[model samples]
Target: MFASGLCFVGVTGIVRYLGTELPAVQSAFLRFAWGVVFLLPALIGVLRSGMPGLHLRLHLGRGVVHVAAVVCWFYAMARIPVAEVTAIGYLNPVLLTLGTVVFFGERLSLRRVLAIGVALTGALIVLRPGLREVTDGHIAQIFAAVFFAGSYLFAKRLSGIASAGQIVAMLSLVVTLALAPLAAWVWVPVSAEQIAWLAVVAACATGGHYCMSRAFAAAPIAVSQPVVFLQLIWAALLGWVAFGEAVDVFVLLGGAVIVGSVSYITWAEARQRRRVVMPEVL
Candidate 1:
């Protein structure tokens, strides 16, 4: 989890360094294009296994949501401070919790509800939509978070029928195909330096997901959930050292509150899992 967090921070730093010189959509496509290179081994593995049949539509849907999310995220990373972007991304899990309740018909306990409320309050503080003029980057992050939540939800559904590697491979293929045209449409001349940065972003993103999967396998979700909070700290430090961005007090306080809420929600989820029934012994 720690490695995943660090890799993700590195990816964000690279994206921020790239800035808005290229269109966000084109930059997002390049990120995925380069990332597909890292997934080639996993793609071969899935093909050799052939256990789960590929669901092209499901993968395509996930890719669509992911493309939108990636575009927004890249845009936000380019225009906003990395720490702020990372802080706003806390909303993804919050939305996922609510989504399960609404879309999956999962029961939401009072504690879970209260926790969600607190997390949203933190988001409001970070966004400060009331006082500050919400820029396009801020709006992008908001929508991107929602799309990311949707992408995760779809991934969870796919996981029921497919191995993680298979799902990831399919997602990569679909994303590459979907974004290829966009990359061509708004293509810009790329220098070797930019290519190097994109390669780093790709490597970090692929490695981050791999590490996250390993973390989940190593520990229960309850244990792993808290590790994600470390990402905000890492992001803040990277943003400061790399970009001279300062962390705001409100973002810290709000992020803490949001983390607390998410921790509570994770505990609740584990408790619910413990209560699930099993078939009688034969």
Candidate 2:
């Protein structure tokens, strides 16, 4: 989890450094392309294994959502402070909880509902929508969170039928296919420095996802979820040291509240799982 957080922070630093010089779509494609290269060994395994049984349509659907989310994220990161982007990204879990209730027919307990509300309050504090005018980056971050949540829901479904390596391979392939045309259309000449940064971003992102997958496999979500809070700290430090961006008090406070809410939700889920599993023993 610590490694995952650090890798993610490094990726964010690279993205912020690149800024909007490259179109968001093109940057996303480049990042994913580099990610695919990093995962070439796994791809080779998938090929040798003759393709893992997977729902192609579902994978493609997830790919679309993920691509959109990545584009929005790039736009947001280019415009906002890295810490702010990281803080705002916490809203993805809130959105994911709502999505599960609405679309997956998952029962929402009062505790979970309260957690969602608290998390939203934290988001509002971070954005301060009415007090200060919201920037396009703020809106983009919110939309990115929503789409990321959608992608995660699809990923959860996919996990039931596919191995982690298979899912990662399919996502890379589908995203490549989906974004290749736009990437070509928006192709702008990039300097060697930009290429190097993009490569670093891709490598870090791949490592981040790899660590995340390993963490999830090692422990239940309840145990692993709290570790994600570390990312905000890493992001803040990276932003400050790398870009001289100051971390605001409100961002820190709101992020803490959001993290607390998510921790409660994780505990609730774990408790619920225990209830279900212990009944057979009883």
Candidate 3:
């Protein structure tokens, strides 16, 4: 997952660079569009073998929410510092944990309750509400995190019925189709250079997900989860070097707390899963 996290840093850099040149909606659309294009061959094969998963509507619904989330994310990237964007993104997993209890009827343990509380505290530290006026970008990122939490909740629902690759392929196809109209409506002509940049974006996204899947397969979530913190560090470095942005100490401290909470959540989850499976093993 370390490599995956690094690849995502590259994705953030490209989106931030193009954020100035392209409309956020269009830029978000192009990234997923190219991702779909690159995955077409594999997707075609998956389809040829007979669509593997049930609940066609569920997959499409995920795509719709993902489109909104990604559009919001692109807008935030354009206006906010990358570190701030990364810091705010740490909320997604926490929100996702809460979402399960609310939407899916999953029980929230004491550990989860504490983790959620800490995550919110970390968010407050990061935002420091009265100290700095929360801008549109901050609001957008919050919305994006909520929607992304929803999207991930859907993914978890589908995991029992489908393979990870199948789920991802379906999402890429659906999200691409979902974005096509918006992209067309707001379409502005772009240079081949822009196309090249978006292609790189697609490649990193695709590769990052693939690497993440491999990481998950290779170890328990608790073991691999902390490696994701490297992404924040990388984003900070990229922001400093490429965009001439300064690191915000609050963002760093807040991100560490958020990451710690997320790690605890994942560790707890892994332990729960093992407890559920131990009887079968015996």
Candidate 4:
């Protein structure tokens, strides 16, 4: 998970460096296009598997939702400080928790509800909308978090029936196809340098997903999720050193609060799962 965090931070840094030179849709499209190249083997497997009709539709739906999230994220990363974007992204797990309750009928305990409240408080601290001018970037990131949470809900549903590789490969293929029209509509000429950097983004993002999957397989979420908190710290340092962006204490503090809340929720969930399984073991 540490390696996964670093890889994601690298993606954030590269996207921020790219700035708004390319349209967000086009940039997002290219990143996944390049990612498709890296995931071709998995794609081939998915193709040969002859996925069920419903499953294919779910994959397409997830891809479309993910495109929204990625475009919003790219736009936010270009315009906002990396740390702020990273901090806002912590909202995904919070939203995801709520989504599972609503969509999957998961039991939402009082502790989880309180954690959700605290997470929202952390987001408010980071934004401080009335106090600071809330830019479009901030709004975009919030939308991104919501869309990402939705995408995760899709993934959670798909996970019961599909291999991780199939899900990743299908998302890359489907998102690239979905973004093609939007990207071409607003496409601007991208230099080779920009393409190279976007390729890096693809590599880092793909690598991060791979590392995160391995991390999950290796250990429980309670053990792995906390390590992801380092992503905010790394983003802050990268923004400061690479882009000369001033470190915002509020962003860091809010991010820490969110992470702590998320960690608590993850630990609680793991404990609950263990308890449920223990009776069977006995």
Candidate 3's residue-wise lDDT over 1-282, tens digit each? 999998988988988888667877788888888887887887887687765345587898899999999989999999998988998999999999899899989998899999999999999998999998999999999999999999999899989877777788888888888888988898898889898898999999888988998998999889998887888899998999999999888888898899999998899888888898886644
Query: By how many angstroms RMSD does model 2 differ from the true structure?
Result: 2.0
| Ranking, TM-score, top scorer first | 4, 3, 2, 1
Number of the top TM-score candidate = 4
- For candidate 3, the 10 contiguous residues with the lowest summed lDDT are 46-55
**Cα lDDT listed for each candidate:** 0.85, 0.88, 0.88, 0.94
Off by over 4 Å in 2: 45-54, 279-282
- Give the TM-score of each candidate: 0.92, 0.93, 0.94, 0.97
Model 2 clashing residue pairs (backbone): none
User: Tens-digit lDDT track for model 4 on 1-282?
Assistant: 999999999999999999988999999999999999999987998899789998998999999899999999999999999999999999999999999999999999999999999999999999997999999999999999999999999999999998888998999999999999999999999999999999999999988988998999999999998898899999999999999999999999999999999999999889988898885634
Q: What's model 1's overall lDDT?
A: 0.85
- Score residue 263 of candidate 4 by CA lDDT: 97
lDDT of 1 at 111: 82
Give one digit per residue, the lDDT tens place, for model 2 in 1-282. Answer: 889989999988889988889999888888888878878898888767764345777888999999999989999999999999999999998899899899889999899889999999999888887788889998999999999999999998988887888889879878877889988998999788887789899888888888987998999888888888889988888888989999887888888889889988898888978898885654
